[model samples]
Target: MLWPREAGKFIASKARDVKINMEGVRKVAKVIADAVQEGKMDVKEFKQNEVLPINKGLTTAQLADWMFLINTLNFNFWTPDGVPKFSIEYEGKIHTGYLAMVACVNRAIDEGKKMYDPHYYSKLTLDDIKHIFRSDTPSTMPLFDERVRVMGEVGTKLIEKFDGSFINILKQVSGSAMKLVELVISEFPCFCDVAEYEGQKVAIFKRVQILAADLWMLFHGEGLANFTDIDQLTMFADYRVPQAMAYFGALEYSDSLHQRMVKEELFKSGDREEVEIRGCSIHGTELIVEETKHVMAERGMDVVGINSISVDYFLWDYRLNNAKELEKIPYHRVRCIFY
Candidate 1:
């Protein structure tokens, strides 16, 4: 089964063994209620145009190119031992991690490179890509070689199969988010995010789902990016959102697992404990969505627009807004391309 569908099935079968607190679900609902009351919980608040690099004055095609490449290399920015973050200095401003990657791509476009052309990147050299993503500081981007390989793979696939544009790929899906997810994973091996849990394979598809979500947000659910099944996407299962979930008391780790996380222990990809953390976070967010809907309906507020995607946006933004407080909770550490 694909993610979210498989995720929901897993939760149904095993959530009783996981430590999900209904009180925590209600607490998140209250937070959403306050934000809604203050007119701050709008789903538009999470749109990519607000944070995308060089977002102004871009045509729809350009935006699709930018989002495609950005999501292609978005993974594992967390570093240890006080290393400076992966950052890019563009137009006198410094951007970090994912934003920094976008800045670099935009900068490449400014330099007269046809960055959106797969033919351009498919034949790119190591030095060329390094210069494109050059950091402002001595600390380089993590997983440099892997990033190059994935970019090359994506560019080659796009050129060979999709007429060299992500827009073409979107057209193939015909505005179905679930179909897009299936196509992305099947076509791009790098976006394949599967894990084994209790001897059963579980799909996460974190990056691909977020890529779809980004498209939905960027196009405001219209035009070529419109997806009829947009609500099918779950909260992107990742390290940061799980940290927020832990802080909000929506997720609790076993004592042994908590100690491992606090100690900054490294977990191999698909490790049982790591899978549990991510899986539970996905399931817990699903519950929070339900709880929030119930709370809103009980108050005679409209629940027409509420969905897991918007709820996830609220939770992710809440973590960023309260990073100081949430930092006390350690996120499970797993370094992999899946997230």
Candidate 2:
């Protein structure tokens, strides 16, 4: 399979329903350059988010297991229209979508479930998951069955292959993020987030790459989190980042595609429009990273920590901050586990 970086550029070259706007990319890149210059664009941002598990003071091994379990079940949090989101009330706040999932895991841990252990979750019954992740909102989590299947599959594989902990696989990688990504995809079939476009196998390993980035941030790039090739990861191309791009005029969708999105039409896993949207988002973010670096260098500003991962984070954060405004731009809906 083509790596994510290569797959991005390749897909952009042939994208029919989605197009990259270079001028918009440069604009967003300038925003990122300013963030970097002001010392705002750093991995520590993850720590500042109290909702993240990083603030829990867990040991490195426990953090790894938690991230492994969370990212394993991270796909398909987006809910259908007019339905309440799968929401959880945690610590007196209602957390929806992805945060809700994280809150559920934390809640399970608080209730004395070994939720992060492979041996424990590998044998979880559907009713167990239902109770663990039960939503305060009316809507159940999307793709509940698929989530259970992949959760058990990865948990069992960890027990069988990596001795029941993701850190074992990390120890074998010798600080190479690429190797970790490759090993995760090779060992866990659920993380094989790839697509076929025009007879070419294109890699959009969103969860795998995010797993690497999460580890890097959790350990602050030291100890077991030292990844020599973290910069090689492309953006975690999911539904929201593309919406943020389009909101910033960086991604332009064809009229038909826009109408479908406006209607909340659910696209299949490997459909052409779906591939184009995600692939173009990846390539567009890559351009944003390069341009942001260029802007920083031309001004003699330090570009020490600029990369696709940071840029993706900025855009995803922007989307969250401007959710009401971005609601004008409908995000493409997909009900697949690969995201």
RMSD of 1: 2.3
User: How would you encode candidate 2's per-residue C-alpha lDDT over 184-288 as one tens digit per residue?
Assistant: 999999999889999999999999999998788777899878987889999999999999999888999999999999999989989999999999999999999
Please give the lDDT score for candidate 2: 0.87
Candidate 1, residues 139-256, lDDT tens digits: the string is: 7667777877988999999888887789888888999998999999999999998887766778878899899988988777998888998888888888888787778888877788
Each candidate structure's TM-score, on Cα atoms with residue i matched to residue i, is 0.92, 0.96
Error of 2 at 21 (Å): 0.4
- After superposition on all C-alphas, the RMSD of every candidate to the true structure, in Å, is 2.3, 1.5
Runs off by more than 4 Å, candidate 1: 8-18, 53-57, 89-94
Give the top-scoring candidate (TM-score). 2
Judge candidate 1 at residue 18 and give its lDDT: 44
Error of 1 at 283 (Å): 1.1
**Candidate 2 local Cα displacement, residue 1, angstroms:** 2.4
lDDT of each: 0.78, 0.87
